[model samples]
Target: MITNPSTSQLVRSVSTELRAKVLPELTDPALLVEVEMMLSMLDMAAVRADHEIAWMMQEADGIDTALSEAAVEGELPAPVRDALHALQLSRPADLTYPEVQRHYGLASEALARAADQAHAGDERLRSLAWSLLEGRVDHELATIGAYVAVGRSENQT
Candidate 1:
């Protein structure tokens, strides 16, 4: 529902900058990539959360009238299709940070990525989602930032 083009663009730019700036601070190139991947994954998670919230809204209303009443009532609604497509895009892989680590042998990396992505989303959600869905990504980003900092610092000395 919060579809401000300028705001969305700013959020994306800030997120990219944060990741790029932070990556060099950590000497481990592998960790850097892992963090990037995790953030990307988390970004997906935020999108998923948003989609779920939207779906819930639709379910409550029996139709997303805001998207398109015709779409919701008709056999094939543009809004419904659009929402589904966004949901599909937002759905994260079914791997948690630990699962991702164990499966890929990048647990720490997974954690960092999750955290970073969450943090980045948090930073943007205020400007992104105008409702309850706004804060979902904050926790993830904070966690990622903490882990990455700790790991990088531990390795530095």
Candidate 2:
């Protein structure tokens, strides 16, 4: 049986080959700089390749969950409530990436508005809103941490 290279492996291999074989041969300084930038982007993509979809799903789920919780509280502004209702009506699993992202954006805006209202009047809702935001931030940091780790390892070598 044969196994296929995973996306991360394929990306890393291409980046390594470019750095070792192609980078040194480039004669134009501007082109060299551009190639270097491309390599950096490739490195980040390689780091994200294995986890990108999962991260996106997690983000969408978090947004959905936050919106649901806010909706139940009944203190959200009318526009925010309507937006959350619209988002809730669409199943995240049934949506494409762009659709999910758009829903998440709407949810995020609504969440922020709810959080602001909570901050002024409701302690429990405020805490819940902050928790959701913190979770989202943590998820983002985990992805960023992978890129930072790659940068550190490259610098150390």
Identify the candidate with maximal TM-score.
2
Instruction: Provide the global lDDT of candidate 1 against the true structure.
Output: 0.41
The reply for model 1, stretches above 4 Å from the true place, is: 1-14, 56-157
Ten residues in a row with the worst lDDT in model 1?
125-134
Quick one: best lDDT, which candidate? Answer: 2
Candidate 2: regions farther than 4 A off: 23-34, 92-96, 115-126, 146-157
lDDT of 1 by residue, 25-82 (tens): 8667677667766655554454444344343333323222222333344433333344
55-97: candidate 2 lDDT, tens digit per residue: 6667657766776776676666665577667666665654466
lDDT of 2 at 134: 87
